[model samples]
Target: MTTITTRTVEYPADGLTMTGHLALPAGVGRRPAVLVGPEGPGLSDVERRRADALAELGYVALAFDVHGGRYLDDIEEMLARCMPLLADPDRMRGIGHAALDVLCTEPRTDPGRIAAIGYGTGGAIALELGRDGVDLRAIGTVNALTTGRAGEAARIRCPVWAGVGSEDPIMPPAQRDAFTAEMQAAGVDWRLVVYGGALHAFHHPPVDQAVRPGVGHHPEHARRAWRDVVGLLAECLPVTQ
Candidate 1:
């Protein structure tokens, strides 16, 4: 197993003191970095584990915070905060950039070789970072295919990979169509993978906590989707020894 270190970090964003979890592979000069965003609920053990997994692959990883360090167990609360924020691109950019800045500040991070990936609301924030024209190597999002304001052109320069569950009601066909159209119109090198018979948040493991309707976990698709995400990252931001 690779040696890795992790710690909690506090930073400001969206008028809140956002807390982030950073993971680094042991014994490293500057390395490619990845910014991970958790689901709408907030940063949890899952996101941190993703960061650790990235560290194991020899990339400096930062799992960013949302909702002021509070995990929204209540679906209503999650919607209340996420709905409005999703409508506001500028706010999402602010949140994404704040974490990006923190990730860049790490000595082990090769700032120019960074990728962003997220789940749920965090996925939307990742997409916003791409649309906001951040110089990311790649953008990978799962279960957050929500479209931006109409007529606003997306300025994503890097390749983008987005995965969605076919049965995800929140990101149904219409939303996927819109997202694809936007990406195509922007002339981005983008691919969308749809997992059959999976629901929203299929990438996430089953939780005992309250889950909104139409949300379920699929172990098989989850694994495959992760492989695709890693492939995208390896293609765009290869980790060097």
Candidate 2:
């Protein structure tokens, strides 16, 4: 059985207490870990499952909670909590860096080889973490709207793999093109994929049914995107175990 572990860590920012999950390969010794930033406002069973899935693939994974202990039950509430953080930008960086600290300091993680993956808003945080010169080896983002922006693209320090849906209204073709241009201009190592006919939150299969019509999810695209993300991580942050 893969050895999965979890704990609650306080992110001294805003006196927030976050409950996080860490999963490691069975018989591991300082395995590389992926610090997973939550989509917005918190951690969910889906995030935990992603961590477990990463462990199953021979890497340690830790999913951090951004919502403290408050879980939003609807889009309105979720957006309310996420808007301010996205607007401030610094709060996004602070929270992402703080989560990274919690993941790297753990004994089971290899400080030299940790990376990050995020979805939607969390993806933005992961990209920010990469741009902030954190010691990340790779970054994977799914259905991210913010990655294509100019200022953030300039700060990335490692290889980036961004997956977006062909039909995603939030991150349409124009935005993807712009983001591609920005990455090229920044001279950052990067890859971009637009899954045909897919929609937003492509990798999030169990997204609230209420969110389905608003944000489509395609299991095939999600799986493909995940495989691509894991492959990129393996290439950029090899597991030393």
lDDT of 2 by residue, 1-241 (tens): 6556555566654457766776767774788889886776467888888888888777878777778766675878888978777766678788887778877787877888888899877888888777677878898888765743346667778898988888888788888887778788888898898899987776776645564454666888878888898899879987665
- Computed on alpha carbons, the lDDT of every model, listed in order, comes to 0.90, 0.77
Candidate 1 residue 37 C-alpha distance from true site, Å = 0.7
TM-score of model 1 relative to the true fold?
A: 0.97
Q: lDDT by residue for model 1 over 87-196, one digit each (tens)?
A: 89999989999999999999999988999999988999998888777899999999988677654436788998999999999899999999999888878898999999
Error of 2 at 27 (Å): 2.6
Tell me the TM-score of each prediction against the true structure. 0.97, 0.90
Top-lDDT structure, candidate number: 1
Worst 10 residues of 1 by lDDT: 146-155
